[model samples]
Target: MTTMFRYPVFPVLPGLGQTDIPEGLSRVRSIMAEPDYMDGDSDELIKPKKLLNPVKSSRNHQDLHRELLMNQKRGLAPQNKPELQKVMEKRKRDQVLKAQKEEQEAHKKRSDLEIELMKRRETLEQLELDQHKDDEEQENTPEFVKMKSNLRRTKQEVDGQERST
Candidate 1:
């Protein structure tokens, strides 16, 4: 069944298609050229579309692509923001902080006064209670209030009296 190995190994004949090597290569057998697509038993036609034609990149192309990617993180920007930032830096370097501190102190004082006023303001219920508790207005006249404040005894005199008692 095997064609290559037979009962008797066929001797090389010079009359065949294969040619003998020259005198220098007495033991060497005949050589063969590389097999071609046209020589194969398969009769399939070549398909150019199925063939691969990949593009190869050199070092320069790869380096250019890497640089492009590295630089594309952001686009070009106007210089206005940098100028404004410089202005802000100048403001920080100037006495703007002192002015801001003064404004903050004034704001704190105003807020404290507002809180005191809110505490002094009477609610509707308190107002009604005051109205009903005394139908007649009390000794709340401005002159009477001023007289009471002026005639009020000194704290030292009151303390001496308490000690004597």
Candidate 2:
């Protein structure tokens, strides 16, 4: 799409005349024409390359080379295990895992036994409490109260006879 540039036109009321600059106004330079914004020297534009310490790097490489050579002398070889070694390692790992599983099972059984004993103790305590309440209820019955009163009367009568004698 093309755009049509439109500018405002002036009538008699808008017929503006040339006006002089304001009393305090002065012409100023633009930032684009300043020296700082212009192209610089090629030498200044291209940065200098960084220097590296090749001697230190070579020393590190030499030390690593010597260490590898000494490791070969010390019989500290890299691991490329034979089939028999691999099989032995696998069996060792399996044994360790089986032992761990057995330990977990034993711990589970012990915890289960503890839980069962705790429940049994709670049930026994509840039964004893129920028995105590039943005994209290029985004592509160009319027959038990009458029996208790009769025993008290008989004891008093015996004491009175003994005193008279």
| Candidate 2 structure quality by residue, lDDT tens digits, 8-126 | 32222244332432334333331123454255555455555778768746988889778878989999985588779999999999999999999899777787778899899999999
Q: For all the candidates, what are their Cα RMSDs to the real structure?
A: 26.0, 18.4
Which window of 10 residues has the lowest lDDT sum in candidate 2? 23-32
The sequence of per-residue lDDT tens digits that candidate 1 reaches over residues 1-165 is: 866854433346667533444435434333344445656665685634654434335677777667766666665333446677898898886778888889899777777778777667756668888887665544444677666665675666788899999
Q: Write out the backbone clash pairs for model 2.
A: none
Model 1 residue pairs with clashes: none
Query: What local distance difference test score does each model get?
Result: 0.63, 0.74
